[model samples]
Target chain A: MTMSEAIEGRAALALLERARAVVDPPLRTALDTLPGPLRRIALYHFGWEDADGAPADGGAGKAVRPALVLAAARALGGDPLTAVPAAVAVELAHNFTLLHDDVIDRDPTRRHRPTAWTVFGVADAVIAGDALFALALRILAEDPHPASAAAAGRLSACVIELCGGQQADCAFEGRGPREVSLAECVEMAIAKTGALLGCSCALGALYAGAEPERIAALDTFGREAGLAFQLIDDLIGIWGDPARTGKPAGADLVAHKKSLPVVAALRSGTPAGAELARLYRTPLTGADVRRAADAVERAGGRDWAQLQAADRMAGAVQELSRAVPDPAAAGDLLDLAEFVTRRSR
Target chain B: MTMSEAIEGRAALALLERARAVVDPPLRTALDTLPGPLRRIALYHFGWEDADGAPADGGAGKAVRPALVLAAARALGGDPLTAVPAAVAVELAHNFTLLHDDVIDRDPTRRHRPTAWTVFGVADAVIAGDALFALALRILAEDPHPASAAAAGRLSACVIELCGGQQADCAFEGRGPREVSLAECVEMAIAKTGALLGCSCALGALYAGAEPERIAALDTFGREAGLAFQLIDDLIGIWGDPARTGKPAGADLVAHKKSLPVVAALRSGTPAGAELARLYRTPLTGADVRRAADAVERAGGRDWAQLQAADRMAGAVQELSRAVPDPAAAGDLLDLAEFVTRRSR
Candidate 1:
């Protein structure tokens, strides 16, 4: 990687962490309003405390989405702090999804720690997630901003779409590899992951009183970046380092997940594709997961996904350019978009 | 019951059915926005369709909550049709709770039919419930009225309280009956059930541009009615005819639920209370459930609950009188409150 790119990436990461720090107090305060156990579950899930209510260094997530909200506001010539509620809402909704997804996926760990469902039990975790969802909307609905209704509406719409996408993703797991097309998988990823990211950016722009055209442009930028993020995430799921990713190598393959690259490989119709499909039809584990990853890569799945993500990044930058006009003004969001695709985890 | 009161009850039931009919189309349209499988599950749950998606007499719920919404609007001299969106939101939120509660309670049946979680898998049912919740908030957020924000905020707050109440109820199930107090049980019931009823009426009044005093008065009326409704529900759970209630006879006793009456009975510290406690400590089925119900009755649980419900109904009527002033104008809402306390199922 170029030295200049590395410096830019570091700066972008710093911006993300700073923005997250700025939103933490209000986010925590908002969550504090939930009933005791539900609040504890949320606090634990957010890496703020332990299951026993002790302090812990359970790492915060990268905060890319919240950063996008703040960045979008600044790019639209508005005070980033004005969009703090939007940032908080997006972060809370993201965590809500994480808690529920952990339950739905039955994953035991997240961010190098036990998932909240494991600690609090599934029922409490599920209910807590619901509370957080309600809280996210409540914050926006009760906000004094004139744009709150639009923002809340968009956020809820995005969440419903996310649920639909998650349903589709779960459905795909029960099917044979060849049954799901690349188009369908991509659509699911866009809905499940991209919609919220886009909504995050658009909400900030909306709160900033940006023109509809600018809001739409920023939304497009965020969606494209989200797609890129998902593509890279799928790549990491298949072949990431366990030490770096905080999960077993090929964890998705072991779970027989119909991830984007896996679906792409199966849809390739090549000899490797046929082999990968046969392997996926059987339950996979241990050596088989490793073998499956090799087959996916051999079918050009890795290269195809990498190229697609790069294309998405390019598209995201194009959208950002249309919205911001001045290249210098768009630096943080653009760097963050690049950082998303470049991350190993 | 007095002949005049019985007539009023019949009229109230008729009003409930009429309100259910009025809200049906919009509610159905809202459900239609969900994806195919989720929509089908909701439709089946609502008694509009059979498991196979064919039309059936699945039977709408008594529509008591929706009726309260419309009746409150009318009592405040607002057009009932103007409050349709509020009615739709409340009903959707109510059903959303039912879906999640079925999963949390692990009950196989609801309304004498297979629960959604059993028909669909638990995960899908959960995600669908989440979608419905988001849709409920979305409906209010997108409403044209200036009161939409306030209504949405209140509804979300009530839901969080409901979650907390459910958490408490579930927690109580793990303890001996004597470990819980009547006050705690009543508080749980109020949060779990009364908060939504209050919010429904309050939303209607808010949408009608009612004064804050009237809104508060109507909220109190609905909450009092909700408490009475729950007290009667506890009674029915213990002794109602299975054929009419669509549940097994003495279901609550069989499950050892620390319901309001059971808590009251246990807290009485009488010989019958001791026997009821002993029976609850052990698992019960068949004749044991009937014996448990008998013990609860002998402990004065039945009489106590009946009197409490009557008192609550009186309080509800008083509140309604204060809000509406003219007794005739408040008649429909008063009848609905009375009907809630007098229901057989």
Candidate 2:
């Protein structure tokens, strides 16, 4: 990329990050309302504190979803303050999924630290996740905006779809390679990853009193961006450096996870695909994790995922164009999308 | 009780049951919107179907919470239809807790059948519970009533409290007997059981456009009834017949569950209390279960719990009188409370 373009992208991304930072105090205050030790677990999970309830120099998440909320609000010419609760609600809902997802996946680590379940046991972790889900809805419902009810309804519907997607992903793991399809994997990814991102933008539009068509366009853009994000994430799971990813190299491959790339490779029907399938049939050790990553690439999975992500990003920009009409107004959203894909590169 | 009083009590109790039966169609329709296999698990859990999705001649729950919604609405002199969504939402929320509770408690059976987690596995059950939680909020958010937002907000807050209470209960289990107190146990019970019931009544009152003070009174009534119901339930968990309770005799004793009666006995400072505490220090066997139950009774645990339940029931009646004012309007709720305690007798 050219130097000017890189600087513009960073500026746009920084703007979104700054907008997300606006949601932190309200989000923390909302979570603090939870009675008893659950507040401690929530605070610790959000990287605000250590296990002992002491403050730590912890990092928050990427805050991409909250940024989408604010950017979409700005794109629609609405007061960003009206969308603040929506942003916080989306972030809370996102973290709720993360907490439960870690438990469901039996993941021991997140964001370079031990998972909440590992720190506080499974039952409390799950309960804390549920509490956060309720708090997210409560935050939206308590907002004084006229659109609060509709926003709460849409966000919850999105959550329902998200859970359904997670269930589908879990079910896929128990199935044979032949029983799985790329289409199914993509659908699950859309529900599991795309739904919340789409909801974030749609909620922002809703808060802005944007026209339904505009909201739909923004939702489409966010959903496509989310798909691109997931495609890149799957690639990172197999090949990205652990230092950058904050996960062990080839973590998904080692678990024989049915990620988009893995499903794509297994369906490639090449000799390498067949070999990869055989390896997946049984458990793998440390050595096999590296071999499996190479096998996926050899089966053309890496190239296909990368191409799909680019295509999805293009589609996202198309939807953004439809929503914004003016290219200049759409510039920041486009830059944010560019930055997302740029991370994988 | 006199025959006339028994007859009057049965008739009033019948009114609430009839109202609950009215909510079934709407409740089932709401659940049907859940995606694919989740709907199946939910249907099976509610005892509406067999594991294979075939219709079963099964019984639904007592629907006590739903009854409170309708009865509370009636007492406020409003159309019960206005509160139907609230009733459905509360019932859904109650079942959401049941699904997750079974998983957390690792109980194999519920409502005379295998629990959802046992039938569908843990992950799906947890996800299914989450879906119900979302669906509950969705139902309220979609309601046309102006009070929908407030009802949704209150219900979500109650759910947050319920999670905190469950967290405390779980935490207590890991601690020594001396670490737990009656006050703490009571507070947990209020949160875990009372909060939802109180929210049910409050939602109904909110739907009726009742004044805040009136809503608070109704909430207090429901909360106290919930406490009484829990006390009786704890007693049944220990001493009730297995055939009648659909559980093993002295099931809590066998598990050394720190139930209200058990905690009370352990705190009694009597010789029987010490013996019971000693027995609880080790896992119980076939004969030990009966001895434990006897020791709890000898420590005045049984009498204490029974008296506490009556006291709470009286307090519930006092609150009900404040809300209803007219004795006739309070009849159904009073009867429901009577029936709850009668089950233990």
True contacts kept of each: 0.68, 0.82
| Candidate 2 C-alpha lDDT tens digits along A133-232 | 9999999889999888999999989999999999998999889865789999999999998899889989988988999999999998988998999999
Specify the poorest-scoring 10-residue window by lDDT in model 2 chain A. A336-345
What's the DockQ for every one of the candidates?
A: 0.79, 0.84
Off by over 4 Å in 2: A239-251, A269-272, A282-300, B246-249, B284-299
Task: State interface RMSD in Å for all models.
Answer: 0.8, 0.6
Q: What is the lDDT of residue B182 in candidate 2?
A: 82
- Per-candidate Cα RMSD to the true structure, in Å, reads 2.0, 2.4
Tens digit per residue, CA lDDT, model 2, B1-345: 799778867775686677667889899999899999899988999899899999876466888788888878888888888789999999999999999999998989888799999999999999999999999999998998988999999999999999999999899999876468888999899899888988888888898899998899889988888898899999999989888877789988887788899989888899989999899989898999989888889999899999999999889899888888999887777777677657652
In model 2, how large is the Cα lDDT of residue A149? 94
Which sections of candidate 1 miss by over 4 Å?
A: A283-291, B241-249, B285-291
Q: What range of 10 consecutive residues in model 1 chain B has the weakest lDDT sum?
A: B56-65
Measured on C-alpha atoms, candidate 2 has an lDDT of 0.88
